[model samples]
Target chain A: MSGHSYDAEKYWKANLRLIFGSLIVWALVSYGFGIVLRPMLSGIPIGGTDLGFWFAQQGSILTFIALIFHYAWRMNRLDKQFGVDEE
Target chain B: MSQFAINIMFVGGSFLIYILIAVWAKAGSTKDFYVAGGGVHPITNGMAIGADWMSAASFISMAGIIAASGYASSAYLMGWTGGYVLLAMLLAPYLRKFGKFTVPEFIGDRFYSKQARLVAVICLIVASLTYVIGQMAGAGVAFSRFLEVDSTMGLIIAAVVIFIYSVLGGMKGITYTQVAQYCVLILAYTIPAVFISLQLTGNPIPALGLFSTHLDSGMPILDKLNQVITDVGFSEYSADVDSHLNMVLFTLTLMIGTAGLPHVIIRFFTVPKVADARWSAGWALVFIALLYLTAPAVASMARLNLMTTVYPDGTAAEPIRYEDRPQWVKEWEVTGLIKYVDKNEDGRIQMYNDASDEPGTAFQAEAEARGWKGNELDVNRDIIVLANPEIANLPGWVIGLIAAGGLAAALSTAAGLLLAISSAISHDLIKGSINPGITDRGELLAARISMAVAIVVATYLGANPPGFAAQVVALAFGIAAASLFPALMMGIFSKRINNIGAIAGMLSGLVFTLSYIFVYKGWFFIPGTANLADTPANWVLGISPLSIGAIGALVNFAVAFVVANATDEPPVEIQELVESVRYPRGAGQAQDH
Candidate 1:
């Protein structure tokens, strides 16, 4: 029982860390590069518009999809590592 | 066959397919009814979620909104898709681990109070019902235009079709049909976009075509769009027309609201495992991105086509003669969505900004010199996607496919929302709170009855839709973001929030968001009943009612924290339950227990 409790705690901590990491990138691409820092990226052009327009409309969505898949893959490995994975 | 006949065949054929699928995948037990027996493959679930998430707004109006608003409307794309990231990381996996038939069930058990459960149920119903109204209205419009019926008759036919499938097979049926709907809608959406993009930019991919050089102008499509629209007194397509603060807040509100919508959240529950739930969100976005990425292309291309059609040469060239208008214009005019009053009676159609505002002012002098009267062409934004095939001169089959796609989009979402509402009533209200000992058969019967009632109510509302019915869908997102999201997130993330705190937080958020919307959008959306006009100047701290959900969420979190800290901590068992849900272990067999 004690070992199980310790594993659960460790799993929870690892999960939180992964979430924090992913969310930082999420915020950066969306609110940061997409809106706030867009002017800085205006010099770099993609397709027809500047990089910021790409991020706002197309790039952010692509990043989000990538982030979710990464999180899912990483969490599955972590679940196995912590001996908490479903059979 | 006539285009109308083709449309009927396509729409009617899709309905027939849905009915067939519903019959084959009939939900025999409550588990099957509620969460498709928790056996859905992640990719399949993803496609279903894609169909379920892209409502009438996304299908029928989103591209039009983007075409009209340009850069500012990217908020919808970003907000809608970004929320799934939050859902995957913040809510979905943990909720799946908790393993319940409904969202409110998790609230009830985790908070250790039936009152908290009931409050969550109320929030779910309010949000889902409001969201469903928009779907019903969208379906009605599609039907009225294609089937040559009145909007009311359209609503009834839509309601009856939805009633048969959703009530019969519940989640199980909705899941498979949505997969089919997703295929139809995606194909329907993309074929026209690809054709238009190729014609406009010499690029096959609409997303790339948006940025590629225009075939005719030999300049970038967006740049040319900006030049022409500005010449005609409209804002540049790539420019920021809205205040920066409003844009940021609006995007934030939509992202949070998207994460909080009950119907979308419930999709995760259908997957077999927590891992499946996480991956399914990624896959769902993959499916949705197919449309989201193309939408801008569709919008820009459609705008370019419409502009060139009306102008016939360039923005500086003389406007096209009304008598020489394309067949599509006359076709759309029958729907009353596109009107031409000919205020100048000048024989030629004059399309320009009529607003006595800053942007309109910029174009007013130019328009006046041209001897143009007030803008004669009042093209409803909703008509853009519906009329896109015709606008692009795509084949009649493509037009027929779009009608089917639009109806599929609306029906798929309406079915999803109806299932959510019915489950809340039968499983949450009747079974969970009212009759814990009710048999499975009785509960299933109750589910069908509740679904029938919900459909009737939604159809009736569709017939006499409030002026803000379209906007009410946005308000639904606000409510979901404000009330349900915080509580659900806290239940998994924090073990300390008690029943009293959760209930109080939900009530405050719901009330605050609702009143803010009512004050601006009319009291309960009653026409002429608003206390103040819904303008940026009249907003509280410049937060429009459309974007007030973010503040409501903050209030919910703050109040919940304050109240929880002031009271006794949650029980040890509830704390342990939260700890359990945080891990993905032991989630394999999450039958509704």
Candidate 2:
């Protein structure tokens, strides 16, 4: 364990943060944007209806794709930072 | 080609595709049978999970349910996709990190008790068996309706096709087969949706078509559909809910329930890395969203078509003749999912909400004028998707595609369910604890035998399904949500939970939820034992038994917490295990394939 070369603790904490952070965002958009916040968002016009309608229909879907890719990238970086990178 | 020939071509062609893919990937070892040797790529795993997730309910019943219910149906869209976020965030990565071949194995090891494993096993078996029954039945229903085969024969063919693909390749084989199934089912769902959307809204994209104004009429398509439907005495489209509390709870329950299902959870274990399991969930949601996005459109378009067929003239004019109903109606009636009874002496099919007692509503006036006694069209809501292509007068290929899509949906999940059941039987039950000295080859043989036996049981149930397809799905969901979800969520989140507490929690949830259902439904659904009649008033607080899973989950959490505090904390290593599973770094190993 010389000079923290096996920095498992630090990298592990960072991975947890990323997981929790992405998950909170994930919950906010689907349950938040699609369900609870849908009515308020619908007040702003998209094409013919309000923004909430779009969120329920299309916007939530786009956000989900982004969330997945973002989580994948962050975790991969975390893996490397901890020297657990798979070759 | 004749409609029958067209149906044959569509359904037959899809099966060929499934076989071709299964041939490409042949499972050899026990690892391949269980977790695809833990070597599937994230993207491929994502697509396979999509096929596995979207079952008969998604493919056959969803669009129809959405179409008939209007705004009240938003529950399906929100509830189904929301669970995926829970999977990606709360469950998948950690489960992969803990890294086991089966879910019961995870529970057994995590709690360090065989009792916990047995409890988890019971929950998994109950939920999965109930779920599998519907898939087999859906296959039978599709075959009976279109292929003109006997329903049992349809189920056998479906079971055989699934067995060949599933037994031949195991999880590795299933992963590839499911990707193909997703393509066929999505194409089948969207092609007719595109045509119908084009016809009604002059928009090819069904998702966009949902919100657009009707090209032939000035009002929004939804607005117009609601207008006529209300005029005919039904509730307004997008009408306010009967109980906001029930709707919210039901939706929340479904989300939690999906996250807890063992078959879906095990899909994450097959991925090669912890992070891949997390990402795989998101991709699964993306593929599911395609059909979900189209479902609202399909429902809207089908509703319009049904209305137009009902009222060729304005709503005030005479309806279509009951004797000379359309081909779609004729086909569905043979399956007994849709039936017509001319309650009024009039020959015209006077469709209305014959149940409402509201004064001055058009329904009352119409019913009085026609001397109608009650709601006469005995159509189950699930018939909407299967009947859509014929309702829209699309070519026979679309109808056949719907048949194939239904089978694909049923089989995809069935394959996943079998893997889960067999994995639990051979790996967790037989090898891990029961007989550890068995060789891998011996374990594999046991797994295959369990899977084959499960298929025969599921097929028999499907051919003579114990209940309606939707009813069976609700029972399965209730069991999964109430029993398995709380235990699993607590396992990772709460380090204080001991083996005794976890077992107690599962048992309490399972008994409470099942007993509540059995009291209302039959005793083990044995027909005469349904103590309470199925009705809103009969339910506690007008909460449907289907919605009772949320309460069961809450009971589970409370019971487990109290018991854990009263008992001792788990030993130090288990806490460290939780800490390790929390992160994605240094947590996964690549299998030697």
Which DockQ values do the candidates obtain, in the order shown?
Answer: 0.69, 0.32
Off by over 4 Å in 2: A1-66, A81-87, B321-338, B357-362, B370-380, B467-470, B528-534, B587-593
C-alpha TM-scores of all predictions: 0.97, 0.91
lDDT by residue (B1-593, candidate 2, tens digit) is 88889888888888888888778777787878888878788888888888999998889888778777775677677777777877886788888877767888878888899888887887788788888888888888789878999888998999999888787788888888898899888898888888888888889999988888888777778777877787778876655457755666677677888888888998888887777887788788888888988988888778777877777786878788887788788877877888788776678777777665643365686668767666667777776687777777888778878888888898999999988888888888888678988887888788888888889888887777665344654677777888788887788877899887887787888788778778788778777888899787788887777777878888888888888889998988887776666655554553321
Clashing pairs in 1: none
- Tens-place lDDT digits, model 1, residues B1-593: 99889988899899999999999999998888889888999999999999999987898899999999898888888999999999999999989988888888998998899998988898898788888888998899889888899888998999998888888899999999999999999999999899899999889999889889998989888888888888888877888535666777788889888888888888888998989999999999999999999998899889888889899887788889999999999998987889988888888888877777757585787788888888889989977788888888888989889989999999999999999999999999999978999998999899989989999998988888766676864578888889989999988888889988998898898889889999988887888899999999998778788888888898999899899999999988888888778877678745866
Candidate 1's C-alpha runs over 4 A off are: A1-4, B360-362, B466-468
Error of 1 at B100 (Å): 1.0
